[model samples]
Target: MPVPSISTKKLIPSIAGKLALAGGSLVFGSWVLSDIVHLPGGGAGLLALGAGVWWVTRPSKPASFSEPSSLPGWIRRCEAVLAQFSELELSLGLDGLRSSREQELDRLKALHEPLSVGVVVSEGGTHPTTSELQIALEGVHSLELCIAKPLPVVADAWSWPQELEELDVILYGLPMPLRAADLLRLEQLPTDRPAWLLIRDSVHQSREARQEALSCQLPKQWCDRLLFWSGESADLRQGLLPVRSHFVQPSRSREITKQRLLTSLHRRWQAELEQLRRERFRSLLQRSQWIVAGVVIASPVPSVDLLAVAVVNGLMVKDMAQIWGCSWSSEVLQVVARQLGTAALGQGVVEWSGQALLGMAKLDGGTWLAAGLIQGLSAAYLTRVVGASMADWMALNAGVAEPDLEDLKRQAPLLVAKAAERERLDLPGFADQAKEWLKSQRYAGA
Candidate 1:
């Protein structure tokens, strides 16, 4: 039988940390207010306490996954698969998928191609690898797994991948595991399995190892089938899909809730925002972009980079930029060069560049990079742009009037700054020429 997994549970600490920080901030604020007027008990103790709480709950790792021992064997099997690798690589397969799963499947699909990579597990029993195959097909990935009659799942930890042919699992109440240890021991096991072992985890090896053990026990028939492509050949591509139990998204409710929450939150935040310094805001956005871009390039964590940039830059996380750029009008200008002549992303994407500067002057400061270059950007691109163009597009898409772009001008300092800044991007342009063009534009802005 196939195994089951769970949603990543290690990330809980991050949420707790945020809550702790908020609680600390409240206490710190009260302490500050009291101290100002020489309250009888005002002191730094409360501030320290608050800081401690923030320190504790701030998310340090992904959520933890703790399984109940009494849960069904299938569920336990799933957890073992996921704990094998980073959540990004382990795909939660079918036989356990819920409704409206396509949205999630697509997101995973967008991240990586499957045919180019494969995971094959030829269990020695009658387990329907096909069922698992269907689940994985959602992402256009394939795996090679061996299967046979059913059997009891053991908690054994010593079952190495090479000797799993002796495992106790029976696909259909069969007599014993179709042992493949001989093939493995002789080193005669075809080199092309491209498969990961799905088994129980102990102190040393993971559940993937267990699965590997099971594979080693396969019957000659199935074993021989794999032997054809077992040789190390470039044409036979295989990869491991560490299985896991994770919830897919693009959920309508999640979308609505996130949108509404951000809208209200940003709106309430604007009161304080009105007093916020432009340069300070610019610095924050720049820092945010660097961090996010760094993550996008450096890690497979997710799309948090673009979203994080939006949050720090005071832009609406979900709203169309053309409609919401007004909210950020004072700090940035966003231009979105769509892939198609229209917004439809059919063929692929082209390129886009954004420049940030001050009145007719190109500005550069510590860690403040004001320009960005984007190549082959996708729908994900629209996500990072901010300013008038964003607001225009959002408003246009939302069926609202294009807010006044009337009387806007290239402020000489900002224009000059933006122009000179252009040279800093990954493009072929001289700073002087870009500067001259920006300076000459009439300062007719919304």
Candidate 2:
């Protein structure tokens, strides 16, 4: 044989390996001998020796490949590739989105033009007063002020032509308190323009007088557009500038009042939007609570009801986030819901109310349907309390980070107690509403 190759397995053993092999053979032989001889102390000695040998000679674990210490190199590489692919896809999508947004912004810019304003003078006031307002407004060339006659007559006198439809704003000069008839006339006017209530009264008027002037109820739709201005503080000299120069002049002092008025209008619009959001939030929350209550009523399990409440509340938070124009993550809402649910449970309101309702129903010889109605109403009440608290929190911190859950938890019990008191007063009405809702559902299902 041409120089036989020596196998690695047949190579001479290291010191440690030799020791391990020798120890294993000796211990194994001793154990067998002790078993055959039945020696009293030898058996224990042999068992201990065998354990030592097994520990020493257990086939060197071969650097276990299955330990899960790290993912395979190929798997890591594949993951990196997938991540890059996802990033590439997102980048492409974002590019298209950015392009579309730029185009939309350009379109909006192209449509932007100067506002055309109309001034309406109250006949109850003198023509000199109308001339004074017209003279003051003459400074603003960017605005075309169409002077119309007083309240009741102005509705018929002012014509709304295709050109007039472009009127961006209206200023009403009211010297006296508005009557209901004046309000009706106002309602009849074109709604395309935002309206301002220019009170000709001096700002130095007594608090009582000012209060009396503003006491009249404006229509809900008009309240946002109807701003108040007083001529008491305006400089007489500053009021008579040419309308053409006013638009071009970059004088800060001249623009101050106009800027202030614009700022006030913006704030009013924001408030209106906020109010609408809250109303929508409340309605959605109530409907969600009702549905969740119905589901809980139908279900036999109590644990499932808790889960349902959490899920429903989480969804409500998402809706609220959209309403408030804030970013939301499901995780944050879940945390909030959990905290709220814990608070509700800790206060024992839900438990006590449910048990009390069930007891009353049982006393009245009630069926499952009666029990469900009680449970559903209780659920709706709890939801209302939670929703109210959430709305308050969102209103206070719109466009901010997610609310502090701990704060919500602390406030929830107190809110629930107050809600309970309110519900007690409104219970009769609520009962009738609930009854109608159930009937409608039954009819729909049928």
Evaluated with TM-score, which candidate comes out highest? Answer: 2
lDDT of each: 0.31, 0.52
Q: Once superposed on the true structure, which residue ranges of model 1 sit more than 4 Å away at CA?
A: 1-320, 323-423, 430-446
- Per-model TM-score on C-alpha atoms: 0.18, 0.42
Superposition error at 318 for model 2 (Å):
4.8
lDDT tens digits by residue: candidate 2, 156-211 = 44343334333455556555556554565566564534455554445677645565
* lDDT (10s digit) by residue, model 1, range 1-446: 01112223442258878789877877777767586665655546566765798698654432222323322332333333222222212222223222223332233223321122122233342322455434543443242233432322342332334333221111121113334332342243223222323221223545355445545766443432221112222211221122211112223322332333233223333322222222233333334434444434334332333343343234432222322233433333322322111221221111223222322235223222323312111112322233212322332222122322221221122322232233235233222433432233213211
Runs in model 2 with CA error above 4 Å?
Answer: 1-123, 129-145, 152-326, 342-365, 368-377, 391-398, 406-433, 436-446
For all candidates, what are the clash counts?
Answer: 83, 1
Query: How does model 2 fare in lDDT?
Result: 0.52
Top candidate on lDDT is 2
Residue 428, candidate 1: C-alpha displacement in angstroms? 3.0
